[model samples]
Target: MGDGRRGSIWSIPEGQGRGSRPAYSRAQITGAAIRIADADGLDAASMRRIAADLGTGAMSLYRYVPSRDDLIELMIDHVLLEADVPERPTGDWRADLTLIAENTRRMWLRHPWLAGLQRPRATFGPNRMRLLEFAFGALDVGFPIDEIFILLDMLNGYVERVVRGEIEWAREMRQSGMTPQRWMTESAPYVRELLGTGRYPMFERIVMDARLPHMSAEEQFRYGLDRVLDCIAAARP
Candidate 1:
């Protein structure tokens, strides 16, 4: 969220550069690629589709992006740069973490494909490094750099785990030709029937709560962040 810099480990290789400018200078191409991923999911966002959107041949884009993986990484980081992380939240770590979590949730919602595109193998893009620096800075908790990285990775892994579950559920629902709500409805009768045996009244009572499943990711993110921070606080002398 800071001023643009070559923060990515995957900066275009020298051969791929065009006299200092990136071989591809058109923001339109990148924007179209992002849109394709957003509208149809990352799998639908091929280099060919992006080129078609730009009215160019797919081969031409190769000068800019050597591979589909690069394009996907760039797309994800580009959209990440668009997220608004407010000024540092002073020393209030709780409020700062909440802001970070909400910003992350909003970014994921804006580009659902991002949750799918990211992988453990992918190198740290510049935007990602900035975000990491941001998280550490906001924490301002005096943890060692390695611990900070581990903590951030844990937080990130948790969010991605949740998002990936949602993505898979959405994909399965689409494949089954049923909305999630419909699938839930169809399963409810069987579930209620199972509960009628009286072996799980506590579970039934929990399920009956009006607020179940209504909590937003932002809320969950904040809840998890605070819980982890509380643990850290407790561990302190």
Candidate 2:
């Protein structure tokens, strides 16, 4: 007979039945998977690979994780533990949101594979639920639930978009020895020629006057986050 925990990984408890003891914990399997994924990527953390890391046969892991999709769901939620979210929102919406944003960015950067996941089904793991509460509660001050949803989505969208670019750029640098400085140096002549054409006044302005293009990635993120928070503030009644 099945335990009846079919669809969602969260529906199944870790050590449910009465037994001597389970040989492996979900955390152990998830941790091994995360380490492999961190080093190689999501696909490399296959059942066989993870089991090999744990010094067991691949079939043994299914007794714990059940399936590859379940394993991935576990892996995604496991790393959310690194976000270091508080038990609840701090009541200062800007500070709370900023904390969430920064922590989320750091988490995604550390686990760049996170930016590649396309799981449309919502997996409400413990850590994910905690962060969700913090985010929604922070924005729950006076706005309607729909607006709160949009605002949170906007904030998360901005953070994810920026981090995705950063991750790709880092990968490019690793694969091809590319860097921002080298890119600028190589593109300088074409940029100069374009500027001399005076055909792109806005591009000229960006080239001649923009400070954001020159800021460090961290600085750029902070500056943009501040602008996003300002917009959120403006939305308040």
Candidate 3:
């Protein structure tokens, strides 16, 4: 990526961040933008497309959200709001966080376009801010606010990484005209050769037991949540 587009696309424009309240609210425009993103991926979600969805001229949207980057940020926050978090303390902390993580994964799965958009631009909309606060409030840990933020950030980062991998795998499958299993089958010979060596007995056992229940995204999310809860328990006074 060229420096100009790289810097501009991933980061919000300076001065654009502190927008005065306008006649047209950002939430309304952001709602329209998110619909566009949901129906079509980010590349197809142009300013003109969003404007059409909002029944406004493209230039009119600029009054609320100046650049495409701002629209992308709004769209992410809007879709994130689609995630349904349970009421606090209704379940164990591990189960509660697992639910949040799985819901987050489902949100990305529903809106694959979300995986492609740059998150650095999404500083925080009301919905996301509330969600973050809810996460912290639900946790039993005694960490400082900054540490809580870092933990939530790490969780979000891990979920995003998983979604991105799924999206990339889907894209590659479409381009290659082969299923992921087929691709793996074709490469299995080399993998087997490496595993067949006596040095990798554990690796061989793990690979040979392919029938062992592989973790789904939901399972993986729950496992990670359990580990986090363990850490939080250890950190308690």
Candidate 4:
């Protein structure tokens, strides 16, 4: 990369300290942003807000970190560090992958704002690279590079969608102050009318039977992960 490119925020090489002690490290700035985003949401994490939190003028922040977009890239990579992608992988690919999925889901759930990050602008940082490397190591199979990447994409997509839905539900419930039980009570009359019409046989049957297991968020995540892993394995050989 060119010198200009090397100095960009996405490049972790710049994170190395200057000869003298710097006023602040990228870790401190990124940490402040993460705390803001985690407590509030992504929009709440502006450069000015973070600068105020760090007790510095907003303009000075630019001297340390280039821009808000770069700070976002830094925040994302810092958040990935919480996932704790293990360096040592189990010999069993399926088990290792399950660990990866669980860790990823756990991180997203902890930081709900992360679910809404713009994917097109995702800039991989140092920790993200390490996370990807660990994930690749977990895939013990002798799959081609293309197929392995496809598997990683599938896994990442599945976890992101699932966690996004889960966070949305919790956010909606909090915003509306309507518990699921209260929601069911409020909609009971309309639901009864729809069921009484006998227009929806499948819905009627599911309601009548209630046979499906009411899995918690974690359980539901694992259930879907298992099925996806099964398909990937079956497709392999």
User: Which TM-score value belongs to model 2?
Assistant: 0.94
By TM-score rank, best first, the candidates go: 2, 4, 3, 1
Error of 3 at 143 (Å): 3.0
Q: Write the per-residue lDDT of candidate 3 for residues 27-116, one digit (tens) a residue.
A: 777776666667777787777887787677887666556677666767777776766775454536566666677788888888888767
In model 2, the runs with Cα more than 4 Å from the true position are: 1-6, 17-20, 119-121
| Residue 168 local lDDT, model 2 | 94
How many collisions between residues are there in candidate 2? Answer: 0
Each model's backbone clash number: 2, 0, 0, 0
lDDT of 2 by residue, 61-165 (tens): 777887777887888888888878788888899999999889889989999988778632367898888878878998988999999999888988899899999
Superposed Cα RMSD, model 2: 2.2
lDDT of model number 4 = 0.78
Model 1, span 1-237: residue lDDT tens = 112344442754535544565445435666888889889987888878988888888877766666665666677667767655554446776666566666766677677777675463445776666765677886667777777667667666766676666667667776887765677788988888878998988878766874535565446556666777676566433
What local lDDT score does residue 56 receive in model 1, on the 0 to 100 scale? 81
lDDT of 2: 0.87
Write model 4 residue lDDT over 20-98, tens digit each, in one string.
Answer: 5568878898899889998989999888898899999877666567766677778888878877866766678888788
- Estimate every model's Cα lDDT from 0 to 1: 0.67, 0.87, 0.68, 0.78
Indicate which candidate wins on lDDT: 2
lDDT of 1 at 92: 72
